[model samples]
Target chain A: SQQGEEDPQALSIQEGENATMNCSYKTSINNLQWYRQNSGRGLVHLILIRSNEREKHSGRLRVTLDTSKKSSSLLITASRAADTASYFCATDARETSYDKVIFGPGTSLSVIP
Target chain B: DARVTQTPRHKVTEMGQEVTMRCQPILGHNTVFWYRQTMMQGLELLAYFRNRAPLDDSGMPKDRFSAEMPDATLATLKIQPSEPRDSAVYFCASGLVRTGRTEAFFGQGTRLTVV
Candidate 1:
């Protein structure tokens, strides 16, 4: 079974609106990272949030992690059409080896222009 | 400018044939991972290596699939007598084993179709 699962498998929003995607995991983790994938291409790293950190921001992207709940959320502010893609959450679980990272199914987001 | 590079962006082969995919991770990154993606199984970790040593490979089929990091920069995944069910996109990612936080950089992936 996968360690991480993202909610609302698919989402759609206006270009200027805010988009939020949530991910839940079943284990203790050292850090969680978010990635975006365009159609027919590989994934691109978005941001990484350590377990000790509660919230992190990079430009219009914001990520929040709650270790107690084993859940994390990614928020994209003022969404643009370019932001339309599949978003995935990956975690480096404490139970796994140091270099291994497990991935979630992902959420497909469509931003309307 | 540092990026993971994968060879033969696409491949198509017949069943019972052998297929191999290669990845060249970014220099200075000591950890490499292999992943398979399909419509049903999302992104699945097949194997991974740290410091050119195989740390884990339980996710891969021992009979047909094998992964190896022959050198610091190159990683290979080979499938012998491939089956139709083996068709999927394979990705390679590399990252550092840091103290608290580590970031994974992914390659463009190699799409394989076993006919």
Candidate 2:
């Protein structure tokens, strides 16, 4: 069973705009990581936010975690055509002794130039 | 420069034929995961290994699917008497679990087709 679920199944925006994707999980998590997948390519790790931390930023990507709500959000500032891809959130549940990462369905973002 | 490696970027097999997919996790990484992705079901976790020990494989179908890690570096997922429904992109990912927090690095994935 999938632990995380991404909202806004699909989104479209023009270049220079911002795109936001949200993910919600059922169980408590040790950390939540975001990944991006291009067409026909494997997923690439973007950023990881630990449960203790509330927010983190890397480059133009900003991630916010709200454990109380069991959710996390990924924000891309000044989106470009290259930013078009599927974004997924994976949760490392704290219920397990070992790290077991489960991925969500993902939110497809399309950036039009 | 280190990355997970998967063999046979593409495979085409007949129904009922046994198929095996191989993955070489990155050196020094102890966790390995196998996932199958299709348009309908999206990404489904098949199995995972931690420290070369089978951790959880309940997500996989026990009848035809089997996953194993012979050593720390190599992991394999095999399907006997493959069916058409089993055709999907299989991905192998490896990550180091440090203090219970780590991000995965994925291979290109094997595009399997069972006709």
Candidate 3:
């Protein structure tokens, strides 16, 4: 079983609109990270939020984590066509050793111009 | 600007044949990971090595799957007598493990097909 699971397996939106994707996990985690992948390419690290942090931001990307709910959300403001890609949430669980990260199925986002 | 490199971006082979994939981790990175991605299974971690030592391989099928890092710069994943179900994209990632923080850099991936 995967530690993290993203919602709305697929999403589509127009440029200039905001996109929000949610992720839920099954266990306690030390941190959660978000990654973006273009088709036929490797994943790009987007952001990371530690267990003690509630929110983080980087440019147009914002991530929020709620430990009590074991959930996190990624928000992209003013979407652009270049933002079209698959977004995955990876969790570093509290019990996991070696800092092993488990990935989720991912949400496919298509931003229209 | 260093990146993880994977060779043979694409591979096609028949069932029962052996397939091998290689990865070159980013310079100075100490941890390497091998993962397989399919439409159904998504990304599954097969094995990982830390500081050139095998740390975990519990997700790998011990019967036909093998992974090793012969040195600090190179890692390999091999499957003998490949099965149809083994057709998927294999990804190699490398990262530096530190207290309270870590980030993995992924390779372009190798797309393998078994006929």
Candidate 4:
């Protein structure tokens, strides 16, 4: 069973425009991490936000976590065509031990140049 | 540069054939995870291991699927008789856990095709 569910199954944006994707999860999580996949091959870790931390940033990526609402959002600033990929929100379940990370259905982003 | 490595980037086999995939996690990282991705089912965690110990494999089909960490640096997933429905890209990731500081680094997945 997937704990995180991402909104906006697919999105199309022009180059340089900002893109935002949201994720809602059930139950408590130790941490929320965002990943990007290209060509349906491998995943690249973008950023991680702890349950205690509300927001985090890395380069053009920004992730915000709201445990109260059991949701999180990823914002891409000044998005480029290269930033286009499938984004997934993965939750490290608090109850499970040994790094039980569950991923949600990803949001596919297409950047038009 | 430390990164998880997976062998046999692609495999094509007939139905009922056995399939074996291997993974080598990054050095000093104690945690390993195996995941399967398909067109319909996004991503599913098949198994997880920490320090050569399997902590969870609830998502896997127990009858045909088996996962093991032969050593700290080696992890393997085997299917006795793979079916057409078992065709998918399998990924392996490793990480060092401590709250939010850990991030699992993944490898180029093994794309399996059962005909």
- How far in Å is the alpha carbon of A54 misplaced in model 4? 1.1
How do the residues B43-104 of candidate 3 rate in per-residue lDDT, one tens digit apiece?
89899899999889988999999999999999999999899999999999999988966788
Candidate 3 regions off by >4 Å?
none
Query: All candidates' TM-scores?
Result: 0.98, 0.98, 0.98, 0.97
The reply for model 4, stretches above 4 Å from the true place, is B99-101
- Fnat for model 1 comes to 0.86
Model 4, residue B88: displacement in angstroms? 0.2
Q: How many Å off is the CA of A67 in candidate 4?
A: 1.0
Tell me the tens digit of each residue's lDDT in model 1 across A14-90: 99999999999998999899999999999999999988999999999999999999999999999999999999999
Q: Which candidate is the best by lDDT?
A: 2
Q: TM-score (chain A) of candidate 2?
A: 0.99
- What lDDT tens digits, residue by residue, belong to model 2 across residues B57-105? 9889999999999998899999998999999999999999898697899
Give the range of the ten consecutive residues with the poorest summed lDDT in model 3 chain A. A92-101
lDDT of 3 by residue, A35-103 (tens): 999998989899999999999999999999999999999999999999999999999778877687889
Comparing 1 and 4 on DockQ, the stronger one: 1
In order, the interface RMSDs are 1.0, 0.8, 0.8, 1.5
Give the poorly placed runs of model 1, Cα more than 4 Å off: none
Return the clash pairs for model 4, or none. none
lDDT of 4 at B3: 87
- Tens-place lDDT per residue, model 1, B1-115, is 9999999899999999999999999999988999999989999999989898988888899999999998998999999989999999999999887787778899999999999
Instruction: Assess candidate 2 and give its TM-score to the true structure.
Output: 0.98
